[model samples]
Target: MQKNILFLVTGMTPQIITETLYALAVDSENSDKWVPTEIHVLTTAKGKIQIRSRLFNDGIFEQFLKDFHLLNMRFDDSTVHVISHQGKELEDLKTLDDNELAANETCRLIKLFTEDDNSKLHVSIAGGRKTMGFYAGYALSLYGRAQDSMSHVLVSEEFEFASNFYYPTPYEHYVGKYNSQERLNAQHAKVFLANIPFVRLRHALPDTHPLKMDGYQFSDVVEQINQSNQNLSLEIDFTHKYIRVNRGEQVNIPPRELAMLMWFADNKVKGKSGIKAPTGKAKGENSVAENQIIEELTADYLKHYDDLKGSETSIVVNKEFFDSTKSKLKKHLEKKLGVELAARILPKQNGRSMPFYLPIESEYITIKDNFKDRLVSIQ
Candidate 1:
């Protein structure tokens, strides 16, 4: 059974888009396992033009047919069907009933993907604007599972994506200079899975089991450009030149990022046939993070939640009372305060004892809530 992946690509960024395609087209590991097919793009008239231009600009058209040498892997550009929302995209589903429309869209996307010979595995791997990614994944989840079609999502480069970044029509931050090779230049990342949408499809047929894929991240993506000897005119650099790892130079991924890299590199998001992100309570804070602050804090908190939860009271007095207090209300206050605060009064350097507050709190009277929400879990 040959796994034919269907990529749902979007956006006008030539370099990033095509570079992602190259990784899949010419994957080094599991070469025989996952084979990507044509792209099913959903965009406006302008975006449709962008796709046409990408074919010529990024050299993706040639790479797929010639460079990667999937001799039989033919791309019928005419089949690059456009599912216009009529100025109304995915989010606009509020206007239409999703239940009926998803059923309709599934048929439509399948029609776009169907070929003359047979029905190819439609793995969704498109990294366009946020909404593009969202809708692409959403539609795939509906169709891929509904009709037993394959669905996937590419894990875009790790960056701080703002929650409200997905804005209204005419998306912002689109760098439109129309350079084809640009897709080859975009940074590569992993693709995650569709838990909710997939659940819908999986629950439909008990016998039909869907495959899940993870990601693979190569540190030296530019080096991939070097290996292919392809040029995109984009300046690629790294502050941490060394990955602290001696080997795994394919993408220069350090040991820390191996798991994440494998998930995306494996085309798990091309419509869910490979490794993917962990989606459950098991995904501690660090599960969804980069070399960022939140993951770090989440780590700390998870480890020290208990230690930080119990409040402590710090108190100090002259050395004279140290002995009496050590035996006196010390344990009494601890029980009364209901915290870990202990008294540690001592003498001052000037031959006198100085009074100090407890180690943590004044007197634990009421139960305090947990600390504020931080990226790390304070132990």
Candidate 2:
């Protein structure tokens, strides 16, 4: 028989799993209805401990199964995945880097699970931090199959977050309400599963094994999918001072920075070595290559000055302005599009004589044209 897998995102609340299972149980009178054959919880080290202590060890999960007489469900510590960074399991998401790692890890596991031909994954986003829930849902969107689904459990307001309210009891049972700490019967509580509609993107990915897909960052995967759909090409509007990345988002840059970016992009088109910015007094204002760069940058900056900032915007072409603009543009690309993608569209630097140049082929870069903005042939 094919497998039914439940992939749950949780923090200190393993109860969500029981509650979700309960919702599945009550939704059908059939004994084996939506009971998963296997369960996997994505959480942190501290969360795993809490789940083991409050749910598995205390017999809460087993008690729920026994109450419902569920014979097919299975879960254990081996099923609980504690997301780790650099080999050490993370206690909790504490910083921006940790969150990025979590997103990547979640995507990785979701990709792995869906890679199996016989597994239908059901993802639960009812517990953990808002970011965690978002990552879980987004990962499913990227790689989820036709049989896979996403949902959240909605508990009645009184029982919501109540310590004693894991699920509606098969028999009369009392649990304390969060606000007044008043006892309420678990059997009377209302629980429902709200199915979330998500766009399936598995078709956009190349047909490859999950293990072979391991090295890709989450953002790169998204970019590749988007590029495939859009047949990615760059559009720069000097008048607006913004460059459109693919067909999705537009990033606004200062005229000076835009000019610097354009110069490097043009060099790629011309098959010229990227000009290296000089340092200290000796490196200032001499070489034929550097002089040509200064001239071109000044012209590009001035060309956009009236349209971008109007006549009030002054154009400066000194070594200081040139250097600062280049640095700022790199930082902006890295910060906005992420390091993986920035490396593609931004100029690459090396210790060789040609210190920097656009790595993208000349064919993909285009200046302003009258093209209808519809799907034009990527030539």
Candidate 3:
């Protein structure tokens, strides 16, 4: 963390606390990068048992989390460090500047509580009860890099679904905690889904690896770290290096297919096999017409689409295009060039749809029958 500002926050909501704790837990156990140096949890006199997303008693939350994690374990490494706040520091600070008192007290705690070590990362995960996400993120902004930057994992809503289900009950948000199946389903889908997995911690646990996730992964994290000019000597050993360009780099490139192939080659992920399709008029040659319905539309973006923040139309189109393009592109890159570009898509606008209406294409993450034969050159 570059900011390295030391401070614990008070008066946080229970939801923030829960989410913040989960965020810290992800890399805390056997992580290769991005670990917090020290953390202190604090609650204020004003902030009391405010459990927003609670599925269990506050006393049982910790044990439940540990048990859930163990059950969901894949790679094993048990190490978690979090300290409970004992608000004695705020005893006599009415006379000092609020910000100054916070800073000085934070520093004093760091000095008194921790021994100076070689740890370069420092974070204040405890802050503004309701704004825990913002505070945690802000603290990291002061000193976080992709390799050692600030990150948060939000805790999802769960429930004590009352139904005929098995162990590790599915966690859900019940409209009615105990009654009204129809009303609860209408009010909260979480509760409805959990109804099937009732009486099981399996239902209580959330999905870990989605087909796709919002944050960066092992590969993207490394790339971001390498690219960031963080004023730190961060060295990433990418075995095979190659030149690349973004939309901003005013450079003429080959066809989208070749550019993607070259991208795979540069990234060292293996793209030599190339797209597999019968060439030279072997079979299904006539279907090429359908293969390029949006031929003019090549995949210009494969990384996540930051531009589709609000616009839903472009989001639909971009997603459809990216999925189709990447499905084909990944194959071409892997087989012919040997790498996989970040093959996700963005949203695009449709000229004909009504205002604020997004077009949903049935095809996503699926390639065409005749897509393998498209030939492209990088140079």
In terms of TM-score, which candidate is strongest?
2
Candidate 2 TM-score versus the reference: 0.60
Q: After the best TM-score superposition of candidate 3, give how far the Cα of residue 73 lies from its true spot, in angstroms.
A: 15
Q: Which parts of model 3 are misplaced by more than 4 Å? A: 1-10, 24-39, 48-57, 70-96, 110-115, 118-148, 152-379
**Where's the lowest-lDDT run of ten residues in candidate 2?**
369-378
Q: Where does the lowest 10-residue lDDT sum fall in candidate 3?
A: 191-200
* Candidate 2: clashing residue pairs, number: 0
Clashes of each: 75, 0, 40
lDDT of 1 by residue, 179-227 (tens): 3223221222333333233433323422221111112111121232232
Candidate 3 local lDDT, 1-379, one digit each (tens): 2322223343523333333433344323324322233334333333333331232343434443563453331111111112223434333223434334344333334333322233343344434433433434333332233323333232223324433211121254334434644423312222111101112111231223111123322233224334332221111111122223222112222244333333333222222322222112222343564345323222322221222121233422233444455456445323321221222121223433321111112121111112222213211
What is each predicted model's overall lDDT from 0 to 1?
Answer: 0.34, 0.74, 0.30
List the candidates' TM-scores in order: 0.34, 0.60, 0.27
lDDT of 2 by residue, 1-379 (tens): 7888998989988888888877766554334457689999999999999889988889898888888778877799999998898889999999998888888888888988998989999999998888999999999997898999889988888888687678888789998877675789988888878889999867753344222355777766666545544444676654456777675588887665776676666566667776565432234457777666666656655544434445644555647775677778877865555444555677667764456677666787765523233213222
Candidate maximizing lDDT: 2
Model 2 / residue 368 / CA error / Å? 23
